[model samples]
Target: MPGESVEYVVVHPDTPVGPVVGLFLLARSLEDAEEIGATVCGRALRTRAELSGFLLLGCEGRLVGPYFDRLLGWAPAGRVMPRPDHDSGNPFLDF
Candidate 1:
């Protein structure tokens, strides 16, 4: 019926424990569904897992590891220094 739109009725009346239990059950079901989906798409899941791990491990340092420094538009602290443009007319000399 058009009048039957989703509505909340307080069945518990007092402390409302039922709705809290229902929410926890719903969360568990969603977690299980994601796990099942991951198992079904294992190869694609591995790609995501590796990417997630790379992101976590790659940024664990205070210095911000090399993998992400370029992405953030900041150069990593010195190993091979980039010469100032005025010092070396050839840009390739930075390497």
Candidate 2:
């Protein structure tokens, strides 16, 4: 399992209407995915006051929305995709 990774969908669960933000991440486990997702979101909140109340809703193995199609277009089967760097700009904008 050296190169194994799973695709996860992370969202902000408390949105009044629905999750306006969706984060896609590749990680070794569900817990790792959630942590990474939360960390990324936390950093964004530091700069964007409007996102203060939002938090990482959760991470799930299933892909959702446009992220699914976007992944299929670029990610190869059974290959671990690279995780975004801490300073790699805003990932949320990519979604």
Q: Which candidate is the best by TM-score?
A: 2
Q: lDDT tens digits, residues 19-93, model 2?
A: 655656566666676666666666677879877776655544343546656666656663336444438675433
Model 1 alpha-carbon miss at residue 64, Å:
39
Best by lDDT: 2
Least well predicted 10-residue stretch by lDDT in candidate 1: 18-27
lDDT of 2: 0.56
C-alpha lDDT of all candidate models, in order: 0.32, 0.56
Question: Which pairs of residues clash in candidate 1, taking residues 3 or more apart in a chain or in different chains?
Answer: none
lDDT of model 2, residue 24: 61
TM-score of 2: 0.40
